[model samples]
Target: MIRYINIKNIFIIYLVALIIMVVLKGDLSDVLARMESIIEQRNEGNWNISLKPFESISSVLDSYNRFGVNIVTVKVAILNIIGFLPMGFLLPLLKKNNTSFIKTMLKCLVFILIIEIIQFIACIGVADVDDVILNLSGCIIGYIFYLIVRPVIKS
Candidate 1:
């Protein structure tokens, strides 16, 4: 039997997958240990937060220069951008009547911020401004692609 998937369903699936990939990343078995470690560190007044934008990008570039290409760093940088592309594309597609670019970008920004906040609170990942920048860039690039393909899809 042929199956059909609607945009809403696709978007929901994508969002869940994205959350799993970002928030629930790494070995699940050690999550409790990691959380306890983070809590202890926090009790010691040590927080994992990076507010400096491009600090991560610069570190990645520096690593590339010094270590002669690190696949992990490259993968992470690329993933940060590529991951959010669907949000930009699918959100507008879902809201056909209100596909305003500004509004879409604002929504994407809010979503990214919420994810970052979760990361900070849960200590699952470093709450870095660079991630926000890169994710937003990906969203914008996705929106651009949407603009390019919108006409074709409409026909």
Candidate 2:
């Protein structure tokens, strides 16, 4: 028989693969633990900072005691950025060709919010408002990149 591949079906496979990777990496537990530790830090009065850029975004960890963005917030935001940006990349493949960028961004934001809620209830991590914002920023950045790169690739 001739080979046939539906792009949507391939995207579903990719999503399943991503979910499996997340589960196998024990990332869920790690995320939970990180959140819990952050909440504990907050309770201990360890949540305050100043506005200064360190070597990397995480370099602020060296001076967390004096910085506004604590380690947990940074970590969670970074995770959201990493996780959701790739997830957004898949949307253009799975979604209708005419889907608007704004709608895609909103869908990514909603997905991040669900993850944030799960993180809060998992008892391993702190549910943070800032994490959602940063994560959405990352998704928007990824979507914009897609917009810029698509025309080039199609040429």
lDDT of 2 by residue, 1-155 (tens): 11124656665675576445432336666665666676787689864222233233445455565766586756644765675565566566455465587778778778766755655454344345655666676777767777777777457
lDDT of 1 by residue, 1-155 (tens): 11124888888999999998988775786666667777888889988689988999999999999988899999999999999999999888886678899999999999999999998888877789999999999999999999999999778
Q: Can you tell me which runs of candidate 2 are displaced by over 4 Å? A: 1-77
Candidate 2: deviation at residue 17, Å?
6.6
Global lDDT of model 2: 0.59
TM-score of 2: 0.56
For each candidate, give its TM-score against the true structure. 0.90, 0.56
Whole-model lDDT per candidate: 0.89, 0.59
**What lDDT is obtained when candidate 1 is compared to the true structure?**
0.89
Question: Highest lDDT, which number?
Answer: 1
